[model samples]
Target: MPRRDRPRRAAFAHLGPLDTPIPISTGTAALTLETDGSVLLDVNGVPSSHLHPDPEHLVFEYMRWMLLVIDRHLAELPGPDASGAASSPPAPAPHLAHLGGGGCSLPRAIAARHPRSRQIVVEIDELLAHQVREWFDLPRSPQLRLRVEDALGALTSWREKRFDVLVRDVFSGAVTPPELTTAETAAHADRVLRDGGIYLANCAAPPGSGLMADEVATLSTVFPHVGVIAEPAHLSGKRRGNCILLASRRPLPEGIDRDLRSDAVSVRLARRPQVEALARAGRVLHSR
Candidate 1:
C-alpha cells in the first residue's frame, strides 16, 4: 500500500484548452446551488451527490442505505455492555474504502460518526476532486485519503485484506462501468476485505433493466451471502431508483433481514433466493 500512501500530486488527466471540449464523464465538476442552501454535484448531468450542511443528513436515499449497511457491520467499535457483567473496551477505528468520490459526502459522514476510522476514496477526476476539496469540508489525509485513480485500479493496487468495509459507487456517466460490474472486480474486492468484511454497491438501474440482477450474479461468483435493499416499489420492479446491493463471505448481521425493514425505513431486504430469481434471466460478467 506504500505505493498509494505517497504524497498526493496534481492529476487532472481530462482538462485541456478552451477549444478542446473534454468528455463529460471525466470533465471538471459543476457545482449547482440548490434553493434550500444545499449543494448539488452535477457530473455529466447525472445529479451526483447532494451535500447537506449536516454530514448526517444524506440527501440521497441510496447513500443513506449504504451507510446503514456500513453501520450494521463496521461502525460498531466495541462489544455492548452486559447487565451486571464486565464491559468490553472500545476498539480501534474501522478501515473503509469508497471506490468513487463524488462530493465525498459519505466519507464526511463517516468521519463525523466514526471520527477515528481510516478511509480511502479513489476519484478518477482530479479537477473535480480539487473542486470538491475547496467547496466542502472533506477529512484531511491519513484520516481520509483521496487518490486520483481509476476505481478498479486503486482497489487492486492496495494490499489484500486491508479494509473492513468497501463501498462501490463509481459510474461512467449514468451506467456503471462494465468493468466494475464483472466478477474480476468482485474477486479483487473479496481479496481487499479482511475476514468478516462486507461489500456494498450503489446500483443505479431502472426496474426490470436486469443490471442489478446481473451485478448480483457477478458478486455471487465471489461472496456467498448476497442481498438487495430497495424501496418496495423498486424491489417489486414497479419503480426506478438506486438499489443497494450487499455481499460478504461471512453471513449478513444477525436478523438483518427482519431488522432493517420497517415503515420508517420503507426498504425491503431480498436474500439470495429472491436475488437469484431476479437475476435468473441475467448473466454474470467476466474478463475477456
Candidate 2:
C-alpha cells in the first residue's frame, strides 16, 4: 500500500494545495493531513474524525475508552506487522454496528486490530459516506460495510440481535440528532444488540448540563447497567467536554472493568455518587 495520498495541512493559516472542502448536500467537510501523517475529517467546521495512517492507533480520548470497553471481552490480539502486512485476530471476532459514519475511524481501528470483526456503519448523508469511504479506503463486507440511512430508521429496522456492540456516535453539527435521544430509540438499539452486548454513545456537553445524564436515564430504561467515563473535571461539573455514556444489559462488575486502569484519566468510571447527581439533572427535567 502506498502510504497517504492526501495533501498535508500546512502551517495554521496556509493550507496545502490539496486541502479542499468535500461538497455534501447540507454541510461542508474536508480532510486535512497532519504533520505526522494522520488525517482529520472536518465537517461543518467541527472536528469529526482524527485518523492515523496506521489504523491500529487510536488518537482521541473518547475513542480510546470506547475501544477499551470492547477489548474487555476478547482475547489479546497480535500487534501490527513491522513489514506492514496484515495479521488477523483469533476466532470470535467482534460484531459491531456503528450508528455514525464520520471518518469511520473507530471501525478502521477495529478492523486492523481485529481483522475478522464484522462492522456496519450507518450514516445519513449519502455523499459524506461516499467521500469518507473513498478517502479512508475502508474495508469491504464480511469485515465492514456501510449502511447509508438515518441511524434511527436503521436501528428500528434491524430484525435480529446480532451486534456485540452498538455505537451511537452520530452527530449533526456538534449535537446528536434528536431522534436518537428518545426512549423508543434506545429500546430499538437495545433490541439490535445480542445478549451481554454494550451500547456506547459520545455525549459532548458543558459541565452541570444534563446531556450526558439524559443519556444515562434513557439507556437505563433498556439497559440494566449504565455508567459514564469522563475526565474528573467533567464528572464533577467543573468543565465542558465529551463523556462516553456506556450502557449494558450485563452487570458492570462482570469483567467490564478489566480495562479500567487508573493511570488513564478517562479510563476511570465516574463514581456512583457522581453519576446519581448527573442523572438527577436529567430526571428532574424529564419529570417536569
Candidate 3:
C-alpha cells in the first residue's frame, strides 16, 4: 500500500500551515505545528498531545509508556517481519476506544503502526476536537472516529466486550475529574471490555499524593490485574507528572520492562504488588 494512502502524518506542517487558536468551553487551546513536523495541541498552557506520524516521536513520557504497553501486546500476535519472512499468523486487528481525544496522538500512532485497527475517540471539548481533526488531517470514519461526548456517557452506551482496549485520558484543568476516577467508572470500563482486555489510563497526581493509590484501588475492584508505569522520578516523589496505569482481567504481558527500555524517555513499571501497596494507603473513591 502507498504510504500516502495510509493514515500517516506528514513530515511537514499540513494541518494549520501555522499555529492557530481554537476556543474551548473553559477557554482556548493553541494548535501549532513545528518546523520539524511535530503537532502540539495545548490546552490552557499545558500540552495535551505532541504528535508526529512516527510512533517514536512521542514527546510525553506517559504517552511513551502507554504506547509501550500497546506495542508489546501487539507484538505477541503472529505476523511476518519487515523482511517478509513467514512468521506466526497475524492476530486480528484490535478494536480500541479512547476516553479523551486530546490531540489524538496515541490514536494516530496506533493507526500508523496497526493500520488494521478501528478506533473511536470521545472528546468533551468540541472545539478542541474540531481543531485537532482539521489541523491533523485525521482519517475519516471507519478507520478513525471522533465523538463529542462525555467519556462516561460514551462508555455507558458501548456494547459489552466490544473493544480489546480502553484508554482513559480525560482531564479537567490539570487534575483528572474525580467522577471519572471512581470505582463506578472502573466498572463501566470493565463492562465494555472483553475478558483479559487491557484498560489504560493517564493519571496525574502530586508527589506522595494519595490520588494515585485511590485510582489503583478503584481499578483493582474491577480488574484482576493492575499496574502502573512512569518515570522513576515521578514514582519516587521527586517530581509531578502523569503515571500510566494498566488493568486487565488476566495476567499482563511479560518483558514490559524490556520493551520500555527502548523508549525515548526512561520508564519504570510498578506491577500489581507495588500498586496495591499504594492503594492500601488510600481510600477507594466512589461516584459522587
Candidate 4:
C-alpha cells in the first residue's frame, strides 16, 4: 500500500468551529471525564472506550469478556512448574496489534495485566490518538505504541505471524467499517497472527439480524474455531448491543464456554456450529 493510494480523510464538518475539537475520520471524537476520574472516548456520541486510572478495573462488560478470552488462552500455555524448582525462564511477552486505538482502554488494560506484552495500535485518527496519549498517560512504546494509519493497510503490510493477539475494534459511527468485516480482512488478520494465536473483535448488530452470523461465517472460513459472546438477552434478540467475536486456528480451550457464561457479565457463548446456525439467515460478507 502506498501513501498516495490511502483513503483521504475529510474534515468533520458538522462540528463546525468547535473549540479544539479532536478531528477523526469518523465524525468528531471527544473525551468525557467520569466522576471516578476515568476517561471515556466518545466517537460520534458512541461510547467507544473507557480508560480507568486503575488498570485492574474494566468498565465495559464486553471488554472484560474479551480479556477473559485472552487470559484463558494465555493461561493454557506451558510455564514453569508450580513448585519452587529451577526451570527455564518464562516465555517472552506476547505481541499484540490493536486495529483501533480509540481511548486505548484495552491496550492500557493489557499493559497492566501483562506488563511485558508489547502492543501496537493502528488508529487512523491522528488527532484523537494524540489526545488519548496526552489525557490518558498511556504506557509508552516498547510497551504500547500507537500507529496513526489505516487498519487494513497496516495489517496488509505486516509480516506473517507478527503478533500473538489481534484485536479489531475499529468503527465508523456505530458500525464497523464493512471492509474490516470481510473474508479478505479476516485472512489478513490470520496472516498477522501467530499459529495458536487469537483474533477478537467488538461487533454491533441488531437482535435477530444476520450481521453477527454473517461475520462469524466469514471468520470461520479462515479460522478453525469461532465463538460469539454476548449477553443472553442480546443473544435472544431482545435488544441490540456489542457482541464479542473470537476466532483461532486451534480449538478453544475447554471450560471457556462455561466460564464465559458464569462470569459476572454472564454472556452467552455461540460455538462454530451455533454460529453457523446464527448466520444461516445471512450471507457471508466479502471485501469490497
Candidate 5:
C-alpha cells in the first residue's frame, strides 16, 4: 500500500496543553505528553485513537471488534462456586498483565467484568500512563497498578509478578517493537504466566504480508499452543489486513464459539475460518 493511501485517522484527543511532543513517524503522527501526564497521539488532527474516551476508547473498528471476542472469552468460563459443587470453576481471582496500555480500554473492560481480577498496565511513555489515569476513570482499586516504562523493560523487572493472562498491544505507526516479537520475548512472557495462562497480541499484517507468518514462527518458539483471530478481510486472503493472535500454554477454553456469538462486538470472531485453522494447527514449541 502506498504511504499516502494508508488510512490516517485521528487516534487521540487533546484534553490539555501539550507538554513534550515526540515525532512518531517521519511527520505523520506526533505524540504529545500532556501536562496531566496523559499521552495523546494526534494523527493529522484526528483524536479517535484515544482508548479511554467516554463513548468509546479505541477508534479502530477492528480493535473494538477484537475486544468483544476477548470479553466473550472471559465471560464463557464458569463462575466460581461458593458451595461444594461437582465442577468448581477456576480461581475466582485472576492475575492479568497488559504489556501495552493504550488508553486502558482492555484493562478497563476486564476490571468491569472480572471485578476480582488484579490488573497491571505497563506503558512505555510516562506521559501516556499519566494521561490514562487523569483522562479516564480507570478503576482505583488496589487490584490495578499502572507502570511507566518500556513494555519489555517492565516485563524483565517483574520478578515476582505472574499473570493468568498477558496481552501485548504495543504498536507505533504500523510497526510493532521488534524486540517484543522475538522468541526470547515469548520465553520471558511464558515465565511470567501461570501454568494455564493465555497470551494474546494485536498484530498488524497487510494482505499477503509476511507479518503473520513471521509472528507465528516467533511465538511458536516459547508457547506450547499458538492461535490467531484475524479479521474477515485477512482470512479471505484478500489485501486488507491486521488481526489478533492468541497463544496459550494450555488448550483454549471450551465453548469459545458460543461465547463469541453471544454479543455484537464478539460476532466478528466467527467470521473467519482461517483463524480457527491456525489455532488448531498450532504446534508445541520447546521452551528454553
Candidate 6:
C-alpha cells in the first residue's frame, strides 16, 4: 500500500458522555470523558486521553505539568509597569499564533498570564474547539481569536502576518502532517515569525527512535538556535519520549532556569537525570 494513501487509525477512543467529575489529585475534580474503550480527563482545559490497552495513570498529570511549564515561562514576561505606563515591558504585548487549538489549553493559559497579549488559535477540529468552550470556563478576553481550518492551510493563506510566538502542537497518533514538519514548512514558520520570534512545538517520539533526531535536524536547518526539554531516559533511549522543542532566530530569555524552576511541575522535573541529559544532548545537536 502506498504510504500516502494509507488509512489513518482513530487517534481517540470514543468515550460516552461525561458528567461525573474525576479526581486528579486530593481535591481537584477533573472533567472525565469515557469512550467505549478509553477514558480521558480534562485537566486545565487539556484533554488527557488514554486507551484501555495503555492505562498510563500519569497522562493528565503530565499534561498539567506541561501547561504549568508554559505558564511559568509566560509569567516571566515583564508585566505592566507603574507610573501609569501605557504599555508593558515587552511592548505591544506579544502577538501569538497557536497552530493547534486543543481545547484552547495553551491559549487560555497565555491569556490569563499575559493579559495584554493577542492570540490567534487555529484548530482543524471545529467540533473539538466548540466542545472546549462548552466544557471549560475560558476567559472571554478580546486577545483570543479562534479559527476553524487546517493549521498549515491557514498559515499558508495568512502569509502577510507575523507573530512573536508560534506554537505548533497538531498531532494524530504517530503521524503528523508531513507538510507541517518539513524544511519548507519551517521556512513558512520563519516568514510568519517576527525578528527574534520564538517557535515552540510538542514533538512526539519513541525511545531509541530517530524521529526526534530527524525533527531537530530539520528545525536546525531553518532556525538559528533550537533547544529541547524532555525526560532524560528518552534521550538516552531508555524510554519512550515526549517533549517540547523551542526554536528561535534570537537568543532565549536570560532567566530560563529561574523561570522553569518557579513552577512546581517544572521544579519537580528540572533536576531529573533524564531532563538534564536531554537538555545537554539537545544543545549538542542544535549547535552549528
Residue 246 lDDT, candidate 3, scale 0-100: 91
For model 2, residues 1-288, the per-residue Cα lDDT tens digits are: 233663443322322234687677558887788877777878888999888777766678788778777776444323344465457434455689999988888998889777878899998888888777767777888798998998878888897687888999988887887778777777877888888788888888766666777777777777777889887778766888878888878765444444666325545687777766666667422211
**Model 1 TM-score, 2 decimals:** 0.83
lDDT by residue for model 4 (1-288), tens: 343564443222222232234666656876666677666677777888876667656798888888888778777765545674567566667888999988888888889778878999999988778777766777899999999999989999999999888999888878899999999999999999888999999989887776887898788788888888888777666889899998899887677677776667667787556777766655778966
State the lDDT at 186 in candidate 6: 77
Sort by TM-score, top down from the best: 3, 4, 1, 2, 5, 6
What does the lDDT come to for candidate 2?
A: 0.75
lDDT of 1 by residue, 5-79 (tens): 644433222322322222434764566555554677777767788877666667887887777777788634354
Displacement of the residue 183 alpha carbon in candidate 3, Å: 0.6
Estimate the TM-score of every prediction: 0.83, 0.82, 0.87, 0.85, 0.70, 0.67
Give the lDDT of residue 216 in candidate 5.
74
Return the lDDT, model 4, position 205.
Answer: 85
In candidate 4, which residue pairs get closer than 3 Å at backbone N, Cα or C atoms, i.e. clash? none
Clashing pairs for predicted structure model 6, backbone only? 14-35, 15-34, 15-35, 16-34, 232-274, 232-275
The lDDT of model 3 is: 0.80
lDDT of 6: 0.59
Q: Which window of 10 residues has the lowest lDDT sum in candidate 4?
A: 10-19
Q: Which stretches in model 1 have alpha-carbon errors above 4 Å?
A: 1-25, 75-90, 255-265
Tens-digit per-residue lDDT, 71-125, candidate 6: 5444554555656665644346767888876556557656755678888888776
Better of 5 and 6 by lDDT: 5
Error of 4 at 52 (Å): 1.5
